[model samples]
Target chain A: MRLTTARRSTLFAGLAIASVAVLTACGTASGGGDSGEEATELGDYEGSVSILAWPGYVEDGSNDPSVDWVSAFEEETGCMVESKTYGTSDEAFSLMKTGDYDVVAASGDASLRLVAAGEVAPVNTDLLKNYDGIFDFLKMQSWNSVDGVSYGIPHGYGANLLMYNTDVFPDGLTSWSAVFDDAAANSGKVTAYDSPIYIADAAVYLMATQPELGIENPYALDETQLAAAVELLKAQRQHIGEYWSDYLKEIQAFETGDSVVGTTWQVIQNSITTGNTEVVLPDEGTTGWSDTWMISSQAKSPNCAYAWLDYIASPEANAQATAYFGEAPSSQAACEFRDDCEAYHAGDADYASQIWYWSTPIADCLDGRTDVECTDYAAWTTAWQEIKG
Target chain B: MSSAATPHVTAGVPQPRDTPARRISVFLSQHARVRLGLLLTAPLFWLGLVYVVALAALLITAFWTVDSFTGQVRTEFTLDNIITVVTGSLYQTVTLRTVGVALLVTVIDIAIALPVAFFMAKVAGPRLQRILVIAVLMPLWASYLVKAYAWRSVLAEGGVVDWMTAPFGGSSPGYGLPAVVITLSYLWLPYVILPIYAGLERVPDSLLEASSDLGAKTWRTMGSVVMPMLWPSIIAASIFSFSLSLGDYITVNIVGGANQLLGNLVYTNVGAANNLPLASAIALIPVAIMIVYLTAARRSGALENL
Candidate 1:
């Protein structure tokens, strides 16, 4: 027993030294809030610029020969574009800390975090000639601006619509109730987004249906309101066929008739050729994402990055990129360049204001109510797990 | 008897060696301790630096927490993450579900593997045995994701399984826990079969013939003689299928409908939640379970066999 105790002590000392080494080696960079480097001056473009974006964004005609935007940009500016696609905003936020990429198309869920962590800098609107053509509504918002300073230029936006099979809802339904209150009618055939951000969708419905609950902003839920939303989600869990984070899975499920009605992205609806599906923005209003092209604070080739951003936001490029990505263009002038821009409700400021865009939930109430302590993203994550169970 | 050779043997002068290797071999034969140490140094360094350090770092991070908004790790030590993981009902439920699925997969794979292995070992002609072995290994050549997608189509509502059972008034189980089990069993069956086949080969035919000569039947001989020797291989096979199924997140996602296992929980905490501390805590569950399984396996004399 005494010998074993001596050996155990030796092992513990070794483990202590090793752990200290690990902690010091992999220490995380501190959280963001600093004013980053000054805005870049437009001049001769650098040789290369790397970009991080969502899957369909920044396509260089590699995946499909017809999709060729980056190649043209490279030829036009002489700045070659190397792009990487991330699945979720959380992943994009984490990768931005590396400071390897020149610019990233970050969604609202990650944009604020990037700003707060000092990973991205405020944009100088004067550098771009086309800034005036962009919609005013997406220019200065809570996600893209801090204290009236614009940190990024808007890219594109899309809503999470209610897509239902005509075979299931023959009478043509029109509310979030088809997936929430009246979900049992299609039990085990409903699908929703598989992310903690999706909790806001439930809160949005409650804002309309259960007005007594006083849920003004879906992103800002105090304990009691969050509990109500969680309970509602738990009830809906029984009817969920699956929760999909990827558009391919959602498309496949819809095509196979495994999912009859639930939340869907515009891209998934477009990809479904067989199913007679219709998507409607419920009267309760839906959740959406407006991505911003924010340059990295430690961008090595700042000139190239700025040039790429301006080129992407230009009329013809914005039209092609947004239409290909299945979203509304950020600039109004891009509408004339594309035939179907009006159909996507591009730059429809009134319609855009009605949608609740995704934002990182925090302890402080984002709805401007200072009284109650709101639940944050971490809590939503844990609660989401519990709801799934 | 040349005078030069005689002088070298008598140590009047040293004889030249052709290469450093020859001199080193002669020196090593004289020093067994040095030879043993040199043989073990590389493997020990590799194991200590990679496996032990990574495991230790993971456990240490389990005690830390991340700031929710920043998604940055704070080095302050606390048991909160571990406590939450242990006390939470969701963790308990998912743990039970994962273990149940793992056990079911192991049973299914073993049931399918044993008879096939037996036939290959004792009954099949040489050519047939070679063909059977190739067939078992052929599925592994295809990508894991491709096979998972194939299963997804097979288990869909109007899929092959549904079409096959249509005349019997039955339907596919349709993407859920059952589908997960069936796919996992199919993926890991080759792993189960090869080890058991090797173990059965180790069983001498003379022993089986002797048992029969002593009036014992096939099942009795298999029960008394063959099973005792095959126990180690069976445990080895269980570890592969069990651990693979236990930590599988991708298969569950492709065809598991709305259900999640421990792997999904860890993945969610890591990627979507961005809570590395919680993810590390959740990851410890499968590690602990696997350690217990391996220890139990070692007690059954399987370690040497593996």
Candidate 2:
């Protein structure tokens, strides 16, 4: 059947419209652009906020009688916090997809994935009164922001410190060489973190000691850099007594004198029962995690989510939460409420700037060097298996 | 038979109407095939829909890949995951180490269980047998994690074993492969012993008497008569210990020092890394091994005896 020019044009218009609709549908699945939902407007609380957090982030004195910030938040805002603690960031990332949680205490490795998947939204700093009090060093970073839009309120931060027994290292150790190069002095007594993310620690050590390696970002390593890191780990493996993923295991090992020195978190040193151990930010800059309180994009209690975020970020609450977790509180005023702020350098932007925050490596270079492809998290996982082998 | 030929039950009762339930029962009773179909419907549905189908779906997923960056499952089929699992040296080493531990644990349990099971079945009086069986089963009442943690403390430096052996100038082996094997053997010993005890109880005293009447010694009778009869139960017990130890990631993590097993690899890929395809591939290793083991067991007529 023959058609007129006008009819043919009408058919082409329909075809073009369908193609654009299909392309946009594809775009929304993964590369969600600008998640069109508006941030919640301030209003009366929604009565509840279901939270997914790391342990001690949303305490109500159940874990320890003194650690109780949720009760105060509940009393003041009337937004009761029903929280579930996850062991790893991966578990938190998976849980966030259910959209059941109102807010998540997400680490840097998981925050970006939540953003990329549109499982979380760009948090409105204006809604959170305490957002301004957050240290400037923790704001608008790579993992917690996308295209300069903040995704969450900074909660707290901590470095992976070089912790050593006081008696074993009476001379006082400085630098990661205590765990890598000089670790042989206490062979069969050294420990390290167990996760594949520990690969970044090796890279951080290399950045200080091996200038010839030309490694810029601890997370953004190419094949050769990853191999070098793996080689160093293999050498370190000889001296390793154990590799600990949980703070409890590390504490037990230290108390029993099975582990004399290793990579550790500040919280682990506090948990040690018998040993007089001290943690330090060694001469080599370290890799660490900065957690943010992110609201779910599909939050059922948006108002309460905002209220809880603001309340948790307040000076007193942030201090209690961070001190309990043994980290530097994000709020500048939290230092006054907590005594160990000097040890953590709570408001010291210089020390915070020195840390290479834990970000999941992607093929696109996180350091913005695009000439060669960077090794991603999958590669790190593979290299880690080999290192352990 | 026709309704006209149906027999009446009682004279005083009113003529019973052919209710649907009555009709179904009547029909099922007449046709053997229908009766079997009706009887098997619930169990067959459960095993087919829940058990077999789920396993088949998981097996199908072994060939798929994941977008490692986004952590989304990609339905598109690929063999790269399977190839990597087969070729990777880490997978090879961990598989070997896991099998070695499982074998050692099985052998140790059998060696220990054989005599204990004999005592429980043949030597112990009825009262002592009951107490011995209760002793073996009591550990299982406690949580698996609690027992594993107990072993952790027992093996820790300056702990129970170290203190007990101080007089002999020996100490605990600390935590590693040896500790893993010892702990697994201790945990699965009861599983091994129960089956052997049951098998031993089935052995008639009259048969042993006949063997002895033919001038056969006790050792010869045990080897020739008791062992052959007990073979199937021993195989069943081994399958229990082997599979349980093969998939144990938690116990190893608790006591294993700087060492990993096949279970740890599968677990990390599935949970921590969010790479399900790789995890599925790694999971298939033990599944294939188990299939082969079951087949071998079947060839030895274990299926009938078990």
Candidate 3:
């Protein structure tokens, strides 16, 4: 019962990787294909176009009946759209890998993996009328591009910030150390992102604490550097009350006083923090990811896919998606459209100077890694289990 | 072998010396021509092909290695995955906890179910028994997620438990572990009650009368006579509860909160980590443990009468 937490975490990390392999096989075997061929022949995009998306990226008929974004796209293009919401980047990639949909709105965590695997094709930027309106920074994002070849259209973007209960940390909370290193004092009060991708948070912290490990960027950690970060995480897990992936669950955890501080995205922070809770951008920079809409390589209706992307990328459409999801829109024109867009806009020229945009931890790019090639996701996933344990 | 031993019957009459064609006709006559026979054969073949073969394939894939960059399974053999699982303390903890919880649920369910099933079978009239059975079965008809959500509301602040305890000067926050247990018990009560009730129904009135006539007290008659006869149904019900709790994800996910379970861990590995090998390895451990416990329980004379 009193075993060193480091040893226990290593053991769990190994188990976590083993579990992932089995689940992937089962998911791929069933429903294996892009939109079927016959669906393409339906005249002038009159038929249903299935798009794979992450939850909350697209509104359904359930959340607010009048807020269905797909209905407007349907009316504009004469194409009825059906979206199957995925809970994780892994699932979305797994689905797209099978070539089953006309489009997949992938997140930064997954879009690179998809492009490297050739599951999604390079979008013809010229064909997309709204492409010109997309911010230059977003068009050249690391995850959605390969050697300057753009693979996806920017859809939604948000930074991962620290959220804390003001009642618990009234002195204007600002550091991750107060959450991770001092977790023992905050036991049964802290929560972290529940996904494997959260291993990046540990990496981000280690670059400062264990500089000898040479972890330049959180995502670009190697095996040895990752092990050091994992050690830090094992110590932190004891303080955690919950590891939440669902936005609704995170909001509930904060509302119920089960969680005091942890990693959070803008959407959950916006929803959870009322008068009692507060969102903080720590002095040490945080991590963020941008979500994108990409045309599938196996698209049955390429023309319709282009049309769908064009309509959704418009200033009016991006404006609506940004307002609904509470994430920053990638289109510059979207911010000019409304006051709500101004609130989400993050630039040197704007007010959100504290927010750090997502950058892949490769050899080049702003805030990129200079150490051993970033920890391949394979190891991070394994380490994540141990961290949770 | 049974067919070879029997002489052919022609129109309810036995044929002492049968021709080859006549024997073939007789063999196919009654058992082979009916819709029921086709239905029975069809299901067996389907189960053998799909369930049995699919499970074997799943086990095979559990041993395969994964390609890191593409996230595809590589065509290579390795024991690293299995060893990783066996050595992992987190997996071991989750596995052990799942089994312990399942056993506790089984014991508690059986204790509660015995009396209810007894009353329905021995004390209640037919009409009353029917109504009671329906009342027990009603929850099963509802969607599982809906039921879990209902339980969450009842356990949360301003929930029914809080409302009931308000006058006692305690806040309406949940007693978390207690709420989870009560919810699981309520959800699986029908699974426990149904089998025991069915088993008790088979206990003949004559057997009870024979015991009573032997100068036995009501309690003694129940203990020595009626109880032994109901062992099979009780064992069957216990098995149902044990398995339901073993692989359950939704109940634990919705109710367990910060407390981790095997099902929740497995769900996370599969859904969040996207590590299929790990998920499969974790999934297999619970199933194997379940089989071992069930086998051991079966050997302890738990199902002798049934």
> Which candidate should be chosen as best, given DockQ against the real structure?
1
State every prediction's TM-score relative to the real structure: 0.94, 0.91, 0.82
Lowest lDDT block of 10, candidate 1 chain B: B1-10
Query: Chain B of model 2: TM-score?
Result: 0.92
Highest TM-score model number: 1
Give the Cα error of residue A350 in candidate 1, in Å: 2.9
- Which residue segments of model 1 deviate by more than 4 Å? A1-26, A29-35, A40-44, B1-42, B304-306
* A1-389: candidate 1 lDDT, tens digit per residue: 25588799998897779667766577653545465865757677779999999988898888998987888889988998999999999889878878889899999888887887788988887897877888888888888887888887888998999999998888877799999999999998999999888899999999999999999899999999999999999999999999999889989888888999999988788889986898988888999999899888888888888888899999888888999989999888888878887667887887797789988888888889999999988899999999988
Q: Measured by TM-score, how close is model 1 to the native structure?
A: 0.94
lDDT by residue (B1-306, candidate 1, tens digit) is 577567556796565666999889999999998999999999988887687777777888898888777777887789999999899999999999999999999999999999999999999999999999999999999999999999999988799999999999999998889999999999999999999999998999999999999999989999999999898899889889999999999999999999999999999898888888899999999999999999888886778766
| Model 2: residue A162 alpha-carbon error in angstroms | 1.2
lDDT of 3: 0.72
Pick by lDDT: 2 or 3, better one = 2
Model 1 Cα shift for residue A129 (angstroms) = 1.7
Q: Give lDDT tens digits, candidate 3, residues B1-306.
A: 455545553344544677898776666675555645666788977875577656655666677666666666664567777887899887887677777778788888999999999999999999999999999999999998889878876776566777788899875444244555667788899999999999889999888999899999999988999888888788788888888888887776565655667777677666655566667777788778868876876797786656
Across all candidates, the chain A TM-score values are: 0.94, 0.88, 0.82
TM-score of model 1, chain A? 0.94
The superposed Cα distance between candidate 3 and the true structure at residue A117, in angstroms, equals 1.7
Q: If ranked by lDDT, best first, what sequence of candidates would result?
A: 1, 2, 3
Better of 1 and 2 by DockQ: 1
